[model samples]
Target: SAWLGALAYGIMKLFGPITGLFVMRFNNRAALMLGCFLCSVSTLVSSFIVSMEVLYVTYSVMYGIGASLVINCVMVLANSYFDKHLGFATGLVCSGSSIGALVLAPLSHFIIQTFGWRMAFRFFSATFVCVGFLNCCVKPIKRKRKGDYEQDKNNTIENEMSFEAKVSKRPSLFRNRAFILWVIGTAFGMFGYLVPFVHLVSYGVTNGIPVSKCTYFVMVLSGATTIGRLVSGRIVQKGYLNSLHFIQLCMIVIGVLFMILPTITSFAGLLPFIAFLGLVDGCYVVLLPMVTCSLVDYNDAILAWGMLAGTCSLSVTIGPPAAGALFDIYGNYNIAFHAAGAPVICGALILFFIPW
Candidate 1:
């Protein structure tokens, strides 16, 4: 199950670049409708599946691709709507995932226990259709024309020409020093990013905490994550720190937390660490697209984000399993947690080499 989950995540992330290209070729509304359609159909089909192999097609590939499209489109739309408070906007928007986990996990669990997995999936499919309808309410922000008609016409022409030039030089994202550094650094950071999420509960249970009580750890983490997203976005929006520097700081903090994670065994002792980790993790996610936008022209920001997501897919895919494997070898999670911290810190330091 763990390996299958990881595979699904990898497939989702691996399609990031394709999702970006799809959005580029079509309007946001069209991309979003396609995503919704795929998600709805995939979930509906998954509800009827009797074989695990078939699940890989319906749940992993189809659902993953749909999710990638939806996520990438949301990021692009968030970037489009706000310039000054991009961090805040993104944080607020991205917090939905944490909120959803906190709210839906228990609901889904209840439904599965009471009804069945199939019914739960059917409910999900129906909810997605509702989401698709809600998305229809989103309209592109129209810029109000101002000044003389001739001035507006000339400005429009210049803007179109500039956009064309940027599109023609799409390969420049690779040649960009900052972009390259950002992608590499982020990829390394991702190596340990999912470790805690996947293992923290099990670690607690294995180290004397009751399984029932340990579940609250996830709730605490999710709640803290929501606050972290909002706070981090506001901080960046206020110009208190550079987005790139802020992300580096968050990565370093998360690495340090991971290193400290294994030393504490008590529930009380672990609470603060879990909360802090959620906070910093939220900050890191909220700042990712903001930093990417800062690194490239607005026209190319989506592509850069796509490339980063695709490049980081490998590390994200292997991170949790690698941690699990280490635990298996050592018969303890101490070394596993420590090992996870190293790559993240190294990645944080690597980002410093990027020229300001």
Candidate 2:
């Protein structure tokens, strides 16, 4: 299931750029609905698969592609409507993910225990398809006529030229130096970010923590992330800090936390660390969109965000397995945690050197 989740996210990232373009070129509502439908269909199909290869195709590839569209289009829609408070809106949109984690993990766990895993997938498939239906409620934001873009009567020709030049000076998504730095830094930052989510339960079990208690770690992470997203969004919205700087700050803390995660022996000791990680990771998620909004012109937010996600998707796909492989090699999660954290520190350094 863990590998399946990662594979889904990775596939989503792979499809991100194309989905992004679809949203930008057409309507977010339509794109989002398409994604939701595909995901629902894929999830439904997964319930019938009995072989590994079939599971890979149905869940990992098909489901992943659909999920990616949903993730990509949601942000694009958020950015489209909320310009000044884009961070706040994005935070709210991303908070839905945390909330889903908080509720669904436990519910799915319970369902698997009570019935069977296939039933759980079937249940979620129904829910996901319902969401696709709900997407029909979204209405497009009415754009103004082209005449609204005409020069003001009070403006001189030279002033109009200057304004045009200034607007044009804001580089396109591919050409923006700050955006490139953001992508590069975020890629490295992602390399170790998923380690805790994937390994924490097993690591705790090995150290004698009860499965029941360790399971709530997911809740803890989700709760903290919920709070962190709201707070980080507000910070960016209010201009308290640049989105990139806030992201780097979170990464620095996350890096240090990963290094310390393996040293704790008690189940109780793990709580605070996991909570803190959740908060920081939540902030990281919200800031990713905020940073994209900050770096690009408003018209290009969706495209830039898609590209950014696509870039980081490479690291997202590789990070967990890389950490797991280290665990196999070293016989302890100590090296894995440390290894996961090291690149984030470097990613932060890269962000620090880049003049946004």
Best by lDDT: 1
Off by over 4 Å in 1: 141-171
Residue-by-residue lDDT tens digits, candidate 1, 1-356: 44546676787788888877776655667777778888899899999999888888888889888888888778757887776777788999989989999999899999999999999999999998998998887775533323445567755765566545545745768899988998999999899888878998899999999998899899989999999999999999898998888999998888888898888999999888888888888898888888887887665677778788899999999889888999899999998888888899999899998888
The 10 consecutive residues of candidate 2 with the worst lDDT sum are 151-160
List where candidate 2 sits over 4 angstroms from the true fold.
1-3, 142-172
> lDDT scores for all predictions?
0.84, 0.82
| lDDT tens readout by residue for model 2, 227-284 | 9998888988888887777888989999999898889979888999888889888898
- The estimated TM-scores of all candidates read 0.92, 0.89
Instruction: State each candidate's clash count.
Output: 0, 0
